[model samples]
Target: MPRPPTMEDVARAAGVSRSTVSRVFQNGGERVSADATVRIHEAAKRLGYVHNLVASGLALRRGRQLGLLIRDATNPAYGHLHAEMNRAVQGVDRQLISVTASRHDYGTAEVEGLNRLIGQRVAGVFVGTGVTAAEDLVETVTATPMMIVGRPNDHPQIESVSYDERTHGRLMADAIAAAGHRRIAVLTAPLLYSRVFDLRMRSLAERCGELGLTTIPVDLLPVEHGVARALDVAREEALSCIVCPVDFVALDLLRAAVARGVRIPEDVSTVGFDGLGDGLDLLGLATVRLPVAEVAREAVTRMEALLVATQEDAEGPPPPGGDQGGVDATARARHLVIPGRFLPGRTLSSAPEHLRT
Candidate 1:
């Protein structure tokens, strides 16, 4: 009928500080003396004490609990990222709490979700949405150990681990050019809506220009989900290929083409990014698959390092959650770009002879 034995009981029995007991259990007695660790374990066994990692994490605030802010969980890419991040977090014996923001609300939903995570006093936060601007996220985090994930970040004070979208764009462009498509339409949202898509489109356009291919930009409005306007532009311009920034857009275009009874590859070729969607192989949609698992692992690794630095800061002169300036040069903000491989699907083929020129 008695309450379960707690860490305090074990600490008192072992004649050690509460923080020392915490370090012994939380970090496998990394810095605790051997005698203290043995005594703590002996006391825990005698008292039938078990460490509650969840309660410990919450109490520490800056412990092994991290936050993630993702957008559009329904989207295959984000879904894959969320799953991989969870796996990564669990692998390191840490806990992750996530918040989802509206994909269409631009920065408002994302900002609010980010603040919610900050209010939890998590050790650090990972921002995985592309809708919010890097500058806005940086300003919002202030001194929090925040890092950008699955989205491009170039701010000197913000760290990031993102897909190599530029490489993805160039790969798609090269595939389209090799198919002999002289003119292609790029379906993408404006920079304000999604910075990743904007960068991919810009890189695609630049590469297309280098390869002497004519590029036509088809602005995708959020109000319209279908790519009917893009199809019309392709038909009117006699474009031989249409490249989509994401697989979802490509799927929409394919559905639109099917409704219009337009033949794929024969009438025109199409390609998209993010090969994470289901049935991609069955559909044979040419695209690039972002390294979601790798990005997640790397982001978690960077976060762990940041948490360590933050802990050290708390023990030292500077306050915990201090600004970037307090951290050493090597521990300062850095960007890591991971590249993805190309999937040569059936959607991309030789341009129709009539539209080759």
Candidate 2:
């Protein structure tokens, strides 16, 4: 069997220094001319010199790898975002290491696992859900660089990227009120796994108050049992429309409503978030389409910047508290709110003439 070509072999073949070969492979050869890059590639190809990323990372002390921590990988909304994040990371020539933290069991075990990733020297981390203000984990994550997605809270050191669920909730309430539906009910899963859902509910409640509309809260069984519970709620409340937090829940609601002979949009309107799937297109459920791809791209970019900033701080004086400390007053001023757009679909419309004012 042939032995793998080494960096020294490539350097000898190209008549360049070993450092030059390393720089070329790492894409950091700013001083090396384009001709040098071409020669290095040719020599490496001829000699079968494959660059080992793990070895390179160890040498530079900066792993070109990212850690992605998520909860509820089964949730379509999260699944979509995860795929987008993976693609974006790969696009930038970085590798992703994914970890699933249990939704119901986020304890010291999870924190220890996350710390292990940091110890392994991941460039940065992107947390999808199930991670919150754990002091130890927060300290470790902030000490390095991290970004959180789909959660509202911000940390002194971590950057958070999520859609304005308040805006989405307000939109849902306004639409239902405009349709002359005064008595509406919102069906959602447990609050623990539904922080975004809770935010939307609060926003909707505020809007309902302003519009002089009435709202009923319906706690659906766990998401896994949503279809049956939502159906039961529709029957009991005679709800004119049901606002759901996700497309899957909305799909379940639609099914239950239909089973009970409830007319969609005509007798009862439905609205949900995270527009995903052509199947939903056929159902025509009104929804707020989250910018999943954009969110992933932005989260990864922010993570990269945070990692770079962390490294710079380690090498030099900590950036001014106001400027570099993610917790500083200046950083607070940098908080960003990206809004979501409401997509009007066939599932929502004016309430029946009798139901309207």
Candidate 3:
């Protein structure tokens, strides 16, 4: 392959010096004339020049980059986190870099992704939803500051900004009890897959038990046979309500139930966590709303603090490889757990007389 185009090529093509090209790409094109900025961009595009933040940052020995490791950015649940965090990063005049975990090779892919960001020399990282699987990668990630967003974790090595899952679960359970849903089907993934799911399930099951509700467990399978399994449990157990741990699964079960001619809240009520999907208002689906914006803002604020601390400690020995002293002596770890909001939609209602037994 021909040698890739360089800043000098862009400068030459754009009728500007190499220093001008560096100023344009490296420093947000400030001080450079608008016409020159446009010309440089057009030239770079024509020359197939790809700006490498990692290389530039390493050369400068300084970069304001915050890494984001999201499980699936396309998922509607994380839309707010992505948008709000982007705004936060811009507010600080910093750059946001993202990596997605491979669904097929989660363990190895997550490790590779984390190392990729570290290699780029980011100031810190704001771990997005489902990245908690990197709990095992703690040792490898500790050199840079980290804050867990979109989910709760007890890892002492990293700060966490998340909503209280237990509280949301209890709120859902209370709503079910108030609505007279005695026999309910709880649809969820296995406990090992998610800490948030595990916490929500544990709280919901306990609270439902206390409320004298009969919970029919509907565990999801790998191939998503859980959707069909949900329909079976809803009918076989004569469940008056379907309480799903997350909205997507609940939506799936609801669609399947509707196809089977089940009247929602008339024949069976439904509730799900996470206010991610749409049509919930139209369907009157009761659910728990995650505090997305709060988590994003906090994640950014915490990262800034860590960055400052990292700079002050630059002369000290390198950060321990493990999660040890994740929070520097100058900054304390922030374990923020904002409460979840419960929307009392029409999906929750009195149990049918037939299922009361």
- lDDT tens digits, residue span 248-303, model 2: 78887777667778777776788888786557777788998877787788777777
Number of clashes in every candidate structure? 0, 2, 0
Ranking by TM-score: 1, 3, 2
Give the residue spans of candidate 2 off by over 4 A: 1-60, 102-113, 130-142, 224-238, 318-334
In lDDT terms, how accurate is model 1? 0.81
Best by lDDT: 1
**Candidate 1 least-lDDT 10 residues:** 52-61
User: 1 or 2, which is superior by TM-score?
Assistant: 1
Cα miss at 138, model 3 (Å)?
1.4
- Model 3, stretches more than 4 Å misplaced? 1-61, 103-105, 131-134, 222-224, 315-331
For candidate 3, write residues 70-161 as lDDT tens digits: 76666666666788789888988998998887544445666557666655656677777563454554544534567788787766656788
Residue 227's lDDT within candidate 2 is 55
Worst 10 residues of 3 by lDDT: 322-331
Model 2: lDDT of residue 73: 68
Which residue pairs show collisions in model 2? 156-326, 156-327
